[model samples]
Target: MSSAFEVRGGNRLQGEIVPQGAKNEALQIISAVMLTPEKVTISNIPDIVDVNLLIELLGDAGVRINRVSRDVCEFQADNIDLDYLQGPEFKKKSGRLRGSVMIAGPLLARFGKAFIPKPGGDKIGRRRLDTHIIGFERLGAKFIYDSDDNFFRLETNGLKGTYMLLDEPSVTGTANILMAAVMAEGTTTIYNAACEPYLQQLCRMLTRMGAKIQGIGSNMLIIEGVKYLGGCEHTMLPDMIEIGSFIGLAAMTQSEITIKNAGVEHLGIIPEKFRQLGINLEIRGNDIYIPSQETYEIQTFLDGSILTVSDHPWPGFTPDLLSIVLVVATQAKGSVMIHQKMFESRLFFVDKLIDMGAQIVLCDPHRAVVIGLGRQHALRGITMSSPDIRAGVSLLIAALSAEGKSTIQNIDQIDRGYQYIDERLRKLGADIRRV
Candidate 1:
């Protein structure tokens, strides 16, 4: 059974909210616990659905898990049951999470074999495993795909490190290949790798575990093989996506919000993008303070042209926050174009905004023109279903800023990425309840 959120909009929310742990970082770091048999202590673990599901999968794989607190845990994979990977339970559980695919690298590196069924997650666009598979193949792992059961099997007598250039700067692919190459024979040089902050955190954690990796925050990485890895403690950075969402939320609702401990150092180009949208935000140390505004104007280019916001690799704007940006622009003073370069279906949620009286023109599957209403007319909420994680939160923000009452169905999508969002919003004076 699924649940929904019944939100009474038009409230000016005001409060200080702390962001949860980085979900993307937690997924990669938790899966990395399988690389060593020693105890690995990780703090700032987010209690969201997707992350908790990954922890459950790890526990089911026979990892010794100790929950120190709501946001901390210790993991030991000394007694993993290799046979469990062949069971139906593993297939059913692992197939539900896209993060399950990440374990293949650790398993293959440490145990010489890995098995995984087709993983599932948000259906935003075409997410291919070619980078991961090709990287593994370059490192001397034999790959076999079973189309009937939708399973992938990989094994290696011994992995020998080699040079490989990724076709794309895939974050998960880089993390996966990095974990595998750290334990292989000889040196592995990976060019065109992802250099996101989360990936850099992974490299630092691996370095603490005695892995020799160069180029922590660059597109190229060189890793020297090691015979074994030891355990180390790691702390997750505050989720930048959530910070971006809260910034957007503050703008959309015209509320005063302070996001505490936002990890602003890692939030490259995010604050500037929001500033470009004409939202007023102040960076007080690590905290982001968004002031309430009656109306904010969108900036035009110096050439007197419309502004365009698009997603790119790290140091560029994140694709995850583009949905929030699109939603926030609905009521600004000027027009802006949202170019969703990564995912084709991400812009489809604008129709829900359009239904709420937002002046938006969906030019194509990947582009939309949002003409700011400038609060000339308030949006009228209606019932809608969330399409994906980012889209779900974007819709929730839209509903919170709309007039009258609104119902958001498929809230599980929101829960997968956000922890107790309704409860947290309530602290900021939002009249939202789970139904």
Candidate 2:
């Protein structure tokens, strides 16, 4: 069923909200359960569409699943039906989810063979699987592509440890390679690996399951292969992207909002970047409190130049929150440049903002200059369609602050990442309805 959100704007929201579990981390961690046949208990799983679909796919493959609660589950892949990987049903289900590709590594490592269909996700840009395939080939896996059926087959007699330097620090690629390397013959050293907190969490969970990994939170990793892994329990971190979105939501709506248990320590440079945009936010232990305000100013650089926000690797600003930052800037008090360095199509949603009365210039596919309207002339509502996950929430934020009623279509894209967003927004006094 298709859905849309009809939002009546100009309402100030005030309340406390808790972020859901990390979506990116959950994808990697859930896929890792395939590495062992023992029962793996995972907690704090987000009740979102994508995660639920992945869990359903695992069940269809014969993994024993125990739904301990809505947010907790135990998975035992003792009797997986490997033949299901070649069926049309598996291809249909896996093709809808990009995270499905992560399963290939564990399947190849344990069973010496794996099948992966062409994966799909956000249409933000070209997310290639070359990094994953190239890493597998380096570890003694033979790769074959069936172009007619749009499938990838990987087989190996036995994977041997090797030294590999990734062309780019792809997060999912690094996780895929790490899962495969944990059970190989000798020793594997991966240079230029992604060191995101999500990757660190995966490493910690794998370590608890008897995987020998060195350098938990660094770019270089060394892993000594083991014969088998045991089952372990894992708790996911709070969604940093959702926390960032809440911060932006409060700023744009001029509302007082408190984010409970935001996992502040893990949010690298996110709050600081919002602070650079002159959004007033305070950290109280692990929680973040954003007070309602009339106006905020964008800070200029020390040399009295326009401040430019760009995405980089971890310990830097995350690319996922750039859309929220761009939307928040539309109502601020100065001009700034948003440089979406990672994905070219990310900034395309600025056209929708421009139609809503935001003073933005689409400089190119990768950059945009937003001149703050200062709330002197309020944005008027209009019907728009969400292009991707980040952009979808960004449009929701814009709609909540606009002058009148607005309709946002394609909310499935939004539901893919955020959990019960419309219901949560209503708790904070937002006039939004799902139709």
Candidate 3:
């Protein structure tokens, strides 16, 4: 794979599509396998570029991993190779994916020291690791910053659980602290913890392995530090971001689709946001039903006022779904405001959509006003480069709805999260090809 994708437009996707396992959850859980040297089995792992790179990272670190089947793998981290951490290739792999930063806590917990490069992900905004560093500092880890080399070294005499409050609820930060806290010496109480489903799953897996944790679903977490964690079997949840993406896809192309085993319980306040956009979603058992509705209108607030869909911490609308919401709003009947509070630069993709004939007002860096031109204006196909993973997929969705075949380069950004996207969308009758 050349780390880019050529997307062909002018196809209406039509078929049943079940999303792959959650990439966000998979990364953390896979790293947690290093908490102990025993073999741990994880199921429902997504086959994606980032995951493949992570597997290679694990192998480089001397962790033994075996693929029992397509959806199952066993990992053993008994022998870690420290020599592998000194090269540019290692940092390159880690720097390309945000999940790479997550390994620091586990590696530090087990080895008492870890070396990590400055983490990287989408170029949309300044995704800070200060929250992560602060969390580790609460656990008594010492940090060294090398601005010249762009590397970070974390070491600690011993980890002790203390009363820590995150300045902001960063998802990866919570996971890092949870991993380090499990092996710490005393009780650690984390207030304002990010309780996203991925973090929740990581906490559950830790508990199953004999780590005592309380307040699993709230902003506060209590972890009783233990000596060692045992091996256990765990599975990653379905990707809610994918579910939201598919919802946008079905609406944009006017297609009927069903999302299976969507883990709706984890989608707090997500479906409600989509409903305001006049997109009807039906919940039947564990599956989601989206019928082909011709005219999707923007619904107003309870006071008959214009609505604003903003991102917040967990239990609030997710920052990941903001891109999809912005794209889907292009075809909606009325106007709505999108406030991307977490990442300042995430709203930049509106320019690409505006070039495609969507009416979007970028109100500063943190907000945008989307006055949907309805389905009357056909977005003409144009050559556009993907900016970020979520925005890349959102642009792909727009390209699918454009008048002619469109070309979107830099699809490697899209591939980081979505697994076999071309294949899965092809099954849904989407006319997308990779060259």
Candidate 4:
């Protein structure tokens, strides 16, 4: 069924909503589960398309899956069919979700070989797999990209510990290599590794499962290979990106909403970045309480230059939030520049916001200059298609603030990341329906 959101704007939402499990964390943790033969139970899994598809892909490979609850599941990968990787259905399933490639790390670590199709997810930009394969090759694994079959083949009689300096702190790449390095013999050192909350949680869980890892929150990691790993239960943190989106939604709609269990400590620099846009986000305990506001003025830099919100590595602003920030800036009291340094095509969605009466200048592919309307002018509803997951939610926020009904199509992109977003918003008094 094709799904679209019918949003009736100009309603002030009010309620408390909890964030779902982090999708990025879930993907890496699920891939790591394939490393051991014992049962690995995980809770707080999001009921979204991408995660569900990855679960299905794992099941197709002969892993025993039990749905303990809507947000809980257990997996036992003791009897995986290695030959399944070469099958057509495997390729078809793996190609649709990018997380499928992460399984190669575990397969290579435990089974001595892996064959994975060139995976796919969002078309945000050129997300390379070089770091993952390079780390593997450095650890005595042989890798070959077969252009003829459009798949990656990896084999290793035994993986040995080695020192690797990643070219960049690629999140998934770092996770893939980390999973593989844990069981490799000797001590493995990875410098310039990604230390996102996702990786930190994964490493913590791996430690509970008996893997020796040093450096929890830093870019440098040391892993002493373990002979075996046992089963352990892990809980994912509430999605920080979703919490940021909700704050933007609350501000845009002038709603008083409390975001519960928001994992505030793990949300580094996100709240501060939102504060730069003059949003009043109060951290009451672990919850984010956003009071209704008519107009929040954007803050200028210390030098009186235009405020610039750009994406950087961990502990800095994220590129994923740039789309939401751009949409929320449309109603602010001042001008701001949004620079998405990671992906070139991410800022192109500003044209759709422009059509809805936003004062925005799309300066090339990577930058956008947004002049605030300061709530003086209301946006009129317009039909638009969602290009990606983050953009899809940004469009939803824009529609909620518009004066009339808006239909946002291609919302499957949104569903792939956010779990039951419409239902959750409705609980917050939003006038949204899925059609």
Using lDDT, give the best candidate's number. Answer: 2
- lDDT tens readout by residue for model 2, 340-383: 99987998888899999999999899999999998888888999
Q: How accurate is candidate 3 locally (lDDT)?
A: 0.87
Better of 1 and 3 by TM-score: 1
* Least well predicted 10-residue stretch by lDDT in candidate 2: 111-120
Model 2, TM vs. native: 0.99
In model 3, which range of ten residues has the least summed lDDT? 1-10
1-435, model 1: which lDDT tens digit per residue? 799999999999999999999999999999999999999999999999989988999999999999999899999999999999878899988888999999999999999999877768988988889899999999999999989888999999999999999999999999999999999999999999999999999999999999999989999999999999999999999999999999999999999999999999999999999999999999999999999999999999999999999999997899999999999999899999999998879888888899999999999999999999999988998999999999999999999999999999999999999999999999999999999
Whole-model Cα lDDT of every candidate shown, in order? 0.94, 0.95, 0.87, 0.92
Clashes of each: 0, 0, 1, 0
User: Of models 1 and 3, which has the larger lDDT?
Assistant: 1
Clashing pairs in 4: none
After the best TM-score superposition of candidate 1, give how far the Cα of residue 397 lies from its true spot, in angstroms.
0.6
Candidate 1 vs candidate 2: the lDDT winner is 2
Badly placed stretches (over 4 Å) of model 1 are none
- Which candidate, 2 or 4, has the higher TM-score? 2
User: How big is the positional error of residue 143 in model 2, measured in Å on the Cα after superposition?
Assistant: 0.6
Candidate 3, 1-435: lDDT as tens digits: 454445556566676888788988888998898899888899999988788788878988889999988679999989888667656778777777677888888987877787778877778778788998988887889999989778898999889889999998888888988898899999999999999989999999999888999999899999999898888999889899999999988998888899889888888898888888999999888888999888799998889888899998888999989999999999899999999989878888889899988999998999999998799887877778888889999999998888877778888888888988988898888877887
- Order the numbered candidates by lDDT, best leading: 2, 1, 4, 3
Cα miss at 321, model 3 (Å)? 0.9
- Using TM-score as the measure, name the better of candidate 3 and candidate 4: 4
